[model samples]
Target: MNPRILLWLAVGLVVWAVIPFVVPRYIADLLVFTGIYTVAGLGIGLLLGHCGIVNLAQATFYGLGAYASAYCTVMMGLPSVVGFLVGAVISMALAYVIGRPILRLTGYFLALGTLALSAIASALFFEWDWLTGGTLGIGGIPKLDLFGFLLDRPSRYYFFVWIVAFACMAVARNLVDSRTGLMLRAMRDSSTAAAALSIDLQALRTKVFVVCALFGSLAGSLFAHHASFVSTQSFTVDRSISFLLIPVIGGATSIPGIVVGALFVTFLPELLSKLGDIHQILFGLALVAVVVLMPEGLVGAFGKLRARLAKRGGGNG
Candidate 1:
């Protein structure tokens, strides 16, 4: 909404558009992966940050997108575009059904309940050999073709992912600026106080959950097509936690923070993998530092700092 943000966003989009012409393919691939996962992370952040819902079923929904897309492509022989919509619908429905009951619970109890959903999904992926190809995994998935155009390249996927990420960010930014966002903040602070005024608690939370889920399913569809191969491993416990950490590390207050967080969570491993076994330790330690020192998240802390600086400048003026 601000001109400063619009300017930066335009510049970033331009850079993404031109990246393939200048950047190496491998680096572009890395960025592409980061962008796709960032879309998923952004969805998680939106739900958790605004709606005050901690979701463990993100990977489950994501896997559904991937699997749905796969089924569409392989079984129905349809293009990924159609598959993407179908998969997204499935995710939205599942989230809605689960959210109706689960959203009422708060704190760790809600968390455990959602975590169960994820566990069940992962189990199905592993056990349903007939549909998902079981532990052996599904391979030889054809490249994603849109309108008969092959989007099998990394840079292509990057552009695609960037578009989706930008769209999700736009939605989130709008929500933050709108009255609905204020309502979510109210509920986050105290549901009793919110309900005292007669807020439609169930509908409000359901809307947010479905919106967040749309992003998750879209991210999953992109992931499926990008990898062209997926399995139970793609929706593992580690991945769920990793996706959750992105917003936490980045600060959940704004989309920019989540983007930065996604960058780190998506890639810090290869950056530290020269030490091989020590990479996980370093990653864990870094996360711990983020938790203990920057608990409000990086973006959130920056917002506070900016407000303080503005106050100081105002006094000086």
Candidate 2:
């Protein structure tokens, strides 16, 4: 392992170890949601960041996972863990089926296609009365039970979500550092050149799309189990947009940026709740400001600052 990666792992371990003791239950719950979004955001990073594919229909897969998990646990009487796995498989299969045609479109056309997919998925969530329970949603989904232990408390769930989130980050990091990651970067930079080099553009695109959907599905499954509920309102175009914003806001190129962006979005509303009606206005302005002032996003900006400081220190020495 790289020394820097090892150092980061050590730091992350410390932070995780300290969070439960230092933070209150409410804050811990917020962190739990943050973890869920982090996993989802990492998926967004893979598609939009690494592959330069704008997947505007991410919420479709997310909804599939949540609905699948709900149906499995409630109707089929399966365990939450099994439901989670089933949700992932369903999301992957659906992404493969839908992504093949939709991904064939590029740029704006691709975006539009995904937007249409999201709209259609949202409609189905509302219209599928028998299976999805329509707008009424499915409730009483079981809590996650691993072996004999049950994650029924906020603190327990906080740890569980973070564990899964970190595992996802590790996988994403591995992908980003491998030859496949190199191919993704090349495809993103210039698909034409990549294709000319015989890079199997279609296969690569489809794989990343499925991977992104898997991450979203995993997050959704966790969300359903966490809240013990599933609703159409939870997965909307607006929500998909939020997931997209996460990588952009946090610096799509950096894995840690995804988590930072996720936490920022998760906590932003609560932090601004004191402003009441003006909170929405403030949130929009804040996002706009971030995009305008820091085109490379928060993590990229921070990295630049760190490099500048290091240069100054080297000069002084």
Candidate 3:
């Protein structure tokens, strides 16, 4: 929509395309991590942006995918490709079943229920010794092989991640322009009015919930394969908080906002961690300041600033 922003995105893609080729493997990894976080955040955008659902159990879907892949590949001896798809399907079915009842609630009640689900999922990951290896997590996840070709190198894996990230963004953009996306947006804006007009509120919310779960699962599958390990710490309540934090910080209404928010939240912290305790304190303070100053979000603030400058210029003319 904004030509300037489109130009910026095109430039960014160009940078991303060149970085792995030029940068060291370890540094390239941080960018990969950012991409992974953005992919997961886009799923949160689908629910929070389009569907207007604050799903507190998002990390459960993520953990489910990681563990599912671990179980299928490491335990069941399945191929990596099969294991990945299986992970997503398992998360989808699980979310669909749970969302049936859970989707009926609204506001605080739905939040509370999803929060409870997050706790349950974490507990299972820790307690299910036989199935999940309990608190120890899973390691030595086999590197993916496409026929005779083995994708064991970091450079090769980078392509896998980038391609998926682009695909996820494309899918979200497409869905937002479709009939289902329109229905989700309408229901999100007002269930009461939607119900008045005969929208099946419960069914619609349930489907969106499944969509969130499926995307989260997709991110999780990539994560497990890339890291070659799965752990409860990697997909827990705090992790879910970070996932929610991104779209809110970026302005949930726009895809670019979520992507930017995810990148900032992911790498900026690690960069600050190197600067000592004062930096950590400043980071927290900065977060609070941003929330208070830009409650409508970063993109919203920028839009307002642009409008104000335009108005001032017109008056001077």
Candidate 4:
């Protein structure tokens, strides 16, 4: 691990450790949702940012995990942990099945394929009344009880969610630093060159797609348990777009950037809610401004600024 990363981790640990004690209950609850969204954002970052795969159907996988957990626990009388596992498995299987063919397409075609899939999934969520409860969705999901300890309170659940989020971040960071991650970057930079190097593009793409879906699955499972509810409204194409925007706005290649983007996106609506009917317009404008001004993302822009400032400081000295 890099010394700077270690230092940042230590500092982050301290901050996370202190947040529950100092933050208000409502704020803690918001943070918990932020953590969930952060995990989903990480998945999007892995696919879109790292692998250069534009997946517009990420929310379908997320919804699958939520619905799977809801069905297993609420309908089948399973334990929370079992439901979580079942949800993750379902997401992985579905991702594998769909990714094999869909990942072959690139650019706008790929985006359109995912968009169509997400639309179909959203329609299914509405039509599958018996399983998904139509528009009302599944309710009464049991709280997560780990080793007989129930995470019933917002503060408690906040810690739990953030722990999972950080664990996911650590895993993503490790993968990004590994050879597989290097291969992914190579594929992203130039699929032709990667193919020339004998890299199995299909296999690698499938693996990363499944891995990305699993992150969304884990997050959805946590969300189902945390909110004690699962609704079709929560998992729509719009939600997928939001997930896609997080990594792009934050800095797709940087794990910390995803987290920051998630936090920003999660709270931006709430902060803008007071702006009456023009909030969405303002939000859209802000997004356009960010993309135009900072093509490499906010984190990358900051890093570049810092490097320039450091060089200037050295020159002055």
lDDT of each: 0.82, 0.90, 0.82, 0.89
Q: Write candidate 1's Cα lDDT for 1-317 as tens digits.
A: 99999999899878768987688887787787788777788777876787677877788878888888887887678866887899889889988998899887887998888888888888988998788887776766678666777788997777778878888888888988898888888888788999997777788988888877787788888888888888889987667788888888897767888888888887787688878899999999988988898788988777788999999999999
RMSD of each: 2.4, 1.7, 2.4, 1.7
**Clash counts for the predictions, in order:** 0, 0, 0, 0
User: Of the candidates numbered 2 and 3, which has the greater TM-score value?
Assistant: 2
TM-score of 1: 0.91
Clashing pairs in 4: none
The sequence of per-residue lDDT tens digits that candidate 4 reaches over residues 281-306 is: 88888888878899878898899999
Model with the higher lDDT, candidate 1 or 4: 4
TM-score of 4: 0.95
Best by lDDT: 2
User: Over the stretch 52-102, how does candidate 2's per-residue lDDT look in tens digits?
Assistant: 888888888889889989999999998777777888998999899998988
What lDDT does candidate 3 reach at residue 236?
82
Poorly placed runs, candidate 3 (over 4 Å): 1-10, 146-150, 278-280, 314-317
* Residue pairs with backbone overlap in model 2: none
Residue range with the least summed lDDT across 10 consecutive positions in model 4: 264-273
CA lDDT for candidate 4: 0.89
Q: How many steric clashes does model 1 contain?
A: 0
